[model samples]
Target: MRNLITFFILNLLCQSLTVNADELTVTLLGTGTPIPSIERFGSSTLIEHKGKYFLFDVGRGATIRLSQIGMYPSDIDNIFLTHLHSDHITGFDDFWITGGIWQRANTLNVYGPDGTKSFVEHTQGAFSLDAFYREKQSSLNLKGLEVNVTEIKEGLIYDEDGLKVSAFRVDHGAVEHAYGYRIDSDRHSVLISGDTTYSENLIANSQELDLLIHEVSVIEPKLLQSNPKLKSISKYHTSLQQLHKLVEKVKPQKTVLNHLLLIGSDETELSHLLETKFQDKNIDVGHDLMTIHLR
Candidate 1:
């Protein structure tokens, strides 16, 4: 009788663990650079767990990419913008349009750096003519679509339902203030290094995180020589070597590379270089619609 009771208790514990593990799902909807690439889309990630959906960035074609993965703009619970880069936010209008057209009941909560509120307001105003025309032509009510924008500095932005999100400023060239987000749930935590070069803040915030989704841009001397414009732009991005050092410090369980540009000649070389540098960690290059089931 005692043995049977112990066995049942262990079984119950295992089942509970399984249920918790199965609830969290993350998908990279688009994983490309500013320059168009046939194989990759722009930078956008969708994180869903326990009926909650969070979008990290709305790069170009984010709506279409999300739809490709069987997710609608209506499914998003929150939209977090890392910065105001054109590549990261060009799809904001699309997301707004789709949400309104679909008649989504939930208001879109957009969080970002200091200038976010005004940026959103400007985008909304730019669409005013279209919104007015649509309302007059079709019976669709455009005024009801609410876009709640919150400009964040640092510290806790959201905490609810066993999930906590913290944002911290990161170093990204002249992009006045950029942010890196740390998302903690009951079971796991992930850090998103949104378009940062290299920062001690990001390293400290991301320590021991389960996953570190960081951007990688190849800025080797040879590559830079070929494209002078890239040299100027690469200052704001993280190189493969720099990323390797970041992984070494944070020592995350997994490092998923997004916003890749000029990843050397071949994918294997980039992967090899990263692996040789960070021997203990697993590195993954992100692709559009790639789903990762977190444990």
Candidate 2:
């Protein structure tokens, strides 16, 4: 009975954030791309450090994913966006409005590359009437409805209270300015590669990292056979074939692949293939609502 009680306590500690105050609490809220899937929501990651909740990207169903881990949209204040891609920022509108409704009294601070301000403005504009109705009809915090936007070009954008974030450029096909983030909090460092096709800049920024959350593009064999044109889409993201080189170069302490392309066969293929190839490396295929307590 004593052992059983200890087991339950350990399980709850692993699932939630009541323990490990000094470590970086990383959660993959959504690991899927624009392609819809019941398993993966979209491209959203939640980072908790120094008692502050920092969200990376607000893709589709982000709020739902957050709720799964006993968190709500209102708990997040700092959100760093990699780019303005539809798959990446589609859930921002929902996170913004719903957070305010749920009592997020502080302003939503958003950091991203150029055109991010315009995107936020347009998103708010599209939901103008709804915001107004809620403001009048409900007991929502007006300040929470407000958002603080920071459009960054490069270099260190955020530095305060032991948190530092650097934004770097990446190659994403036709997109002029897709970026990734290097987030560090004294004890732990994490790199998030938002939709990119193997950028050398990532290598420059990612060194001695505790956790590396990167994207991998792999369309299953059947999907490619059915629609050969879809192969071009892989050009925009780092393919499974090219990922080993990046992993070798960056050589992070740990790697979690995010923004996974759909189809169960491919997920299995990715696991089995990488398991054989990256046998010595600590790598994992991320799933939605997956939590990691970085030590």
Candidate 3:
């Protein structure tokens, strides 16, 4: 009887682990460019694991985009900013406003690089007048809502409840200091290369990751012909060929190309080019609202 009880306990523990392992899901919220599009927003990605929601890079329209997917701003437990670029942080104000209006009881945690605290303070200051008026008119006090800002460094930024998140510095040119994030749970890991140029560090850090989501730009002849300035900027971003090489080296289980530039072209050819370079790995082109289950 004692042996049978021990056996059943071990089996139940194994089943619980398996169920928790399959709970991580990544959702691509806004897989578009700085320039607005009818189909896509800017550059936000939502990660859900073990009943917790984390938002990375809340670009323009991210709050509304979340609403479209049946998630409120309050649903986000943590917000990780890759950089302070306008395209990346523009929707932060909207997130603040929506969370305040809804009167969420929980405090929101915002994490980012060096200037994160000042940025949040400035944003809060900008909303001060509006917050005052809302407080006067309604039962909810907007200004009373807490927004905790933590300035992050290189190593592990967050670790709790079997989930660990780390940040690595990435090259995004002189505009701002940028970072790529890696999130690891017990059974799966994901890497997000947030608007970076091709970096050896990212490739090394992302090796054997379950999912690698990196930005990609197109350098086809027609794009170069249309806009010379855009062509120059594309050099600072990751090109299809560069991404192909990175995938070849890191060899992640799946490679997702996102933050697409020069889209509406032959995406299949681009995927095929990447696949030929990194054989035996799944290559996917990201679209807004696309969800991938991480097992």
**Best by the lDDT measure:** 2
lDDT of each: 0.82, 0.86, 0.84
Residue-wise C-alpha lDDT for candidate 2, range 5-112, written one tens digit per residue: 999998998756533555788999999988888898989999888778999999999998988888878888889999888989999999998888888867889998
Number of clashes recorded per candidate: 0, 0, 0
TM-score of each: 0.90, 0.89, 0.89
Candidate order by TM-score, decreasing, is 1, 3, 2
Q: Tell how far residue 274 is off in model 3, in angstroms.
A: 4.9
- Model 3, residue pairs in steric clash: none
Cα lDDT tens digits for candidate 3, 22-59: 57799988888787886778889999988889999998
Q: In model 2, where is the ten-residue run with the lowest total lDDT?
A: 14-23
TM-score of 1: 0.90
lDDT of 1 by residue, 139-217 (tens): 6676446788888879999987777889998989999879988988877888888998878889878866788889888
Alpha carbon lDDT at 194, candidate 3: 92
Q: What shift in Å separates residue 223 of candidate 2 from its native position after superposition?
A: 6.4
lDDT of 2: 0.86
